[model samples]
Target: MSIRKLAVLLVLGGMAAIPALAHGPHSLESMAMPGATKTTSSSRATVSPAQLKPGKPQAMLIFVRDGRGRPVERFALQHEKLMHLIVVSDDLTFFDHLHPQYVGGGRFRVTANLPASGSYTAFADYLPQGGSPQVSALHLQAGSGSTASVPLTPDSPLSKRAGDLTVTLKLDSGSIAPGRQTPLTFFIKDGNGNPVTDLQPYLGAMGHLVVIRQSPVLTAADYLHAHPEDQGGHSMGAMAEMHHTHGERQQMAGMDQMAASQKAEPGSVSFKTVFPGPGTYRLWAQFQRNGKIITADYTIAV
Candidate 1:
């Protein structure tokens, strides 16, 4: 139930994910010490246009550097990509899972478009060679408007119906605890309440789940994300496998895709995760049915 345990459930076993999820505000001293595997910085991102335009693609370039401010090159692949970039709006209404391309000397490039004008955050998740995996956040503003600040109060929406699917989140643990692994059971059913079967494989997994912290990084854990499985553990899309003869990744550079798919217990899956801190969070579960992607949104207080 520790951070290390939670990290293991995400990036395969503890060996892969522990080094990555270890990046919360609670453990900064270990990163600042000399000869540590991870690097520290004030946290910033350079945005082109200085302001994001609504409904238009905006360029984002994040510089991965060492403590010396020099660009750090070489990234280890995680979840079938070099970097997994997550973008979310202030209200948590907008969510995107993107893969960026390493275009040059320590710069990853990706084009993002926002449907509405507001504040958005882009988190770059990657692991530099010889360095620990890190998730660095960058804040950006878009368009012109006097939009009121989005509220961040905890919303406990346990059931959500999207199209023909009704997703009910069953927290079997009764109460969630920080730093403890809570088992979450998701049920996918139709309007008639019958379980759904024939769920297709998406992005090399039975399903994909993303949990973003409300109001940004105020708690010990903010913006938590992880795919249920990528390879070996589950099946991947045929369209994606055609991209590579070795049946590997589909070269996800420049794609803002929401991934999903599944088949087991017909419409039920159970996953255990750890919340780094006590705070409200928005949960997004992505799955595929009838060859169309299905997204379900809900909220929970941990």
Candidate 2:
């Protein structure tokens, strides 16, 4: 399923308000870093996602290494942990933050039971020798009924390198008018100019894009309204109808709920959202591949 199709199903299913459930042995405290370094090592890591039986627990393996492609020590002191594994579904549901147990050496393993079959993204965040922190996004297909193996090769279209991913914002018109619904599409591609297909779920969705209005005039009242009665989980109406005009900031509402309703199915993932107020907005999309995590940022005027 395409990302857009997945988004439509999630909205129509009335399951947007559900919060993603976290399972496993690792805690956020163990993965926290006291400080981040500006430089990262040159080593290239690799990650692979194998499809497991539907309704059964699934697992993803991550292999870390040094600049020479040698596996690094599991308990390396350079970073807090050798590797951090994050799983997200296409629809932004089924988010899991797990610390894969290092099975000796540099191999890490995480156990996950995909609720259903679909395209999911697995991100590996780690520190390389003599380098700062690096992230990579990898695509995995579950329950597709096709036993064909999708290799994570350096030349694969779905596998984007550290410096190749980019996102561009385009509006239907030259400018967006207030109180009007506008269409926004994010054009994403790798450095080699390939469309990202196997977009795996990361943190419970095909991918996570955070958009924050830059104006101080944009407040919660102006962006999001309390949907105490919105049982259907459609919070866009409340946010778009906010009364405040300017000078307030609010995190996009309904993320936790949207993250919870994720179910695994086949295909790409997508969704639609409207900005409550008009201003310069910053959007961030995070994904992982090749045992590394990559975040792409874009600024747009709405």
Candidate 3:
């Protein structure tokens, strides 16, 4: 049976339904997060109608469970959100960053918009109250038509255009390899080829980078998420701190303002991470400009 089928079976077998909570969205201060323990958690996703058809949106429900089969109720915040759900097509042609709304119990709800009928993977990134960060992969399938896989290929040019902006990706070592910390820098320029100096803060940071290795079936081990560096480069931590102090609504008032404008180089954003193994990885670099989020995709080889 396929992973998606197995997930449905598991949910139907014995997973208990949880009650809805009356409170609103959680705040970091209200959570009272504790130190991380060794406890492990797992996640499973189910579609509303049991079958997803092309060009139609389906409600996707994700359940977070502990090792003993009970629902996980308490969760810590990561990047100002409780859960970050990344949905991507197997062919690497589609991508979406979403935050599922926590209704109650361990279940979160979000709508999945699959443009075409294909196999897709949902990576659930969250932190249990007493556990470390976790990534759970839930396989999702729409009405089966063509399961044709796309061959992963590296990009010849490191730079690409996102809307009216041009994003150029660069590695400090000139190339990436497994087991080594690689610094990835993105230089932003306008359509006129001028440096972009007023990049706005996004998701409590200067930027966000998500890396997923190309594979026939992706597991949690194949996904990696990174934030920008702090010192000697763009610092997401510093920008996140500012957002924390000023409050999200107040800080987000000015779309054209820069957070750490004077510290980092103009038109540049940086992130660092180590590849799990040698293979082709698809990267999505997201940043904000004039209150709009732009995602630039690039494929790199290790």
Candidate 4:
């Protein structure tokens, strides 16, 4: 099953059937990537002060290494960054997308500002220079108390308000079943309920989706990340080719004008992905409008 190509709305016959049991490191999407290596890389994140307070910022250092315990120095750019770090509280109420700065020696550094004292999960999503995409789940403890929290429940309505925009999400299939590639579409409207047509290019794409299943202890197997399908119906390889041939600056410039030129449906974007298993999942959809990034979240059962 290849995820390198975008599936047309009318043609779903060739979509990949991702296994319900496969996720994180063993996700078929990453395994099917071009030039994926058998030897996987590893990463570990350590937070300073060990114990965190309710409203203070803490320094986080992540070290990437090979399977042989050697530091992996080189990394490939994905989504305009070397690493994409996603953090969420155990209760699923807090979510943050952070990009750690590479400080050499296979180390990346960032500051984490956890709102309350509890257990948090940090998912490190990255690509080694010569390896496949990797996801490493790290643990962070705050305040050294019982790690108990409220149970996660599915959202009643799929619609949410982010700033002045109202976003509603819909799934192509009536019910989202495990092991099936489902197209998740989002529609945006302004405060006055008119469809919003002017969305900016964010992180080289129309939008980004990050999902994590509710679990006692979150791991790489419980995480998934996706991007909006290319409007031009181009494969991932073709997109990469355009990125390199024209350079990041040029490619981004071209993408900035794509919304106006394509004349696509007003305020609608879709992403096709597979749910590894049946569980309650929290999803965060991020987009940019008028140069400000907005995040809207939803909870759903598979």
**Candidate 1: residue 146 lDDT (0-100):** 24
Measured on C-alpha atoms, candidate 4 has an lDDT of: 0.66
CA-lDDT, candidates in order: 0.56, 0.39, 0.65, 0.66
The residue-by-residue lDDT of candidate 2 on 1-302, one tens digit each, is 11111100001011111111223543211211111111122222212223445567755455544444344653432112455555545333344545666665455666766667765544454543333334444334467742222221221122223366654444455446655644444445667676554443343233444444443221112221112111234333343233112102112223332342233221122334566766555444555545455565444555
User: Relative to the unseen true structure, what is the C-alpha lDDT of residue 39 in candidate 2, on a scale of 0 to 100?
Assistant: 13
| Candidate 3 residue pairs in clash (backbone atoms < 3 Å) | none
Give the local distance difference test score of model 1. Answer: 0.56
Give the per-residue lDDT of model 3 (tens digit) for 100-153. Answer: 877667777777687888777677777666445667665556667644557878
C-alpha lDDT of candidate 3 relative to the true structure: 0.65
lDDT of 1 by residue, 84-152 (tens): 777777677788878878776676767788778876666667766544556655555677652343655
Question: Candidates sorted by TM-score, descending order?
Answer: 4, 3, 1, 2
lDDT for 46 in candidate 3 is 37
- What TM-score does candidate 1 get on C-alpha atoms? 0.68
List pairs with backbone clashes in candidate 1.
206-261
